[model samples]
Target: MEHSEHTEPRPPGLIGSVSGLVKTTLRLVMSRVELALAELSEVRDHLVKLAVLFALAILAAWFAIAFGTATLVFLVWETLGWKILLILAAVFAVLAFVLVKSAMKLIRGGFLGMPATLAEIKADRDMLL
Candidate 1:
């Protein structure tokens, strides 16, 4: 009876393998960072647009509300007088508040980071551990 045992050859050196691994890991990190930057850029654009829209809306609403309130207060001054001014002021405050809250809602709708890339990095960390 004859028996044979075959073994694979040893790797040339450890440094080469380590260097290759490091390069690959760095490449992954760079790619993830790029993804994050792109995501941030998109989020920034959306936020900028939201900011501009809210600014215009707030300015226009304030002007219109102010003028309308002044007109109504003038008409009611002889009767209700100062009380009419207070009521108009309250109404204007409420509407302005609503406008601000709506803008906040829009701001909350988006995120400023690359969620997928972050998740991938977390997964990689776990795998390495």
Candidate 2:
């Protein structure tokens, strides 16, 4: 006759349980950071677009003033002719204003920061507490 030995699984000690908790928390934080990084990348793309729009607005404004003044002085020397020059100036000014307003909206979009990351962290904190 032969006797068989049986082994039972041991329960996790304090140290093991603590280490597991730490590892899990670290993993959760890392995942949230990855999400934040992705959001920041998106913000970068938006910023580049806004910069281009701002540049265009400045160029339009410059041209409006330069050419409008030149036209008024050289071609539209008469008082009545000044109206057409002023109208052209007004049109370009409007275009520039629109572009500037668009850029401002992007600036205030509140996406420049890690908004999602902050929200996730807040939720995590709330859950933990």
Candidate 3:
């Protein structure tokens, strides 16, 4: 009798191949995260960009609301009487004040928090090997 070497059989079907692919994908993702951490050094410019974008958004919203209110007042004045239009203007003014106040609060909060957030991201990135 001749002695034969036993060979391991390969796993059959799509499930085994899929599991191997998933594991390889996860490893690649993990390596990319590591590389990103190592590569991320500065965020000051990024924070500044975000701040500018926030400011622009607030300015745009303010201008849009103001323009819309003006247009609405003009329409109302043309259709309704001046007295009713004045009352509407006053009501809109008060609402605008409230909205402005809220928006200012939000801007203040975002401005205060953004630097700290950027700092944290930088610090975390620094800690990565």
Ranking by lDDT: 2, 1, 3
Q: Candidate 3: which pairs clash?
A: none
lDDT per residue for candidate 3 within 1-129, as digits (tens), equals 666797566876698889888997688567656655544434455567768987998899889877887787777776676776677668878987997898688667754344544555577567653
- Tens digit per residue, CA lDDT, model 1, 12-95: 588878888999999988988898888888888977886898789879977987788778888989999789978877877897
Instruction: List candidate 1 stretches off by more than 4 Å.
Output: 1-12, 111-113
lDDT of 2 by residue, 54-88 (tens): 68977897897787778666775675666776777
Cα misplacement distance, residue 9 of candidate 2 (Å):
5.8
What C-alpha lDDT, on a 0 to 100 scale, does residue 49 get in candidate 2? 84
TM-score of each: 0.75, 0.65, 0.32
List lDDT for all candidates, in order: 0.81, 0.82, 0.69
The candidate, 2 or 3, that scores higher on lDDT is 2
TM-score computed on alpha carbons, candidate 2? 0.65
**Cα misplacement distance, residue 20 of candidate 3 (Å):** 56
For candidate 2, the 10 contiguous residues with the lowest summed lDDT are 1-10
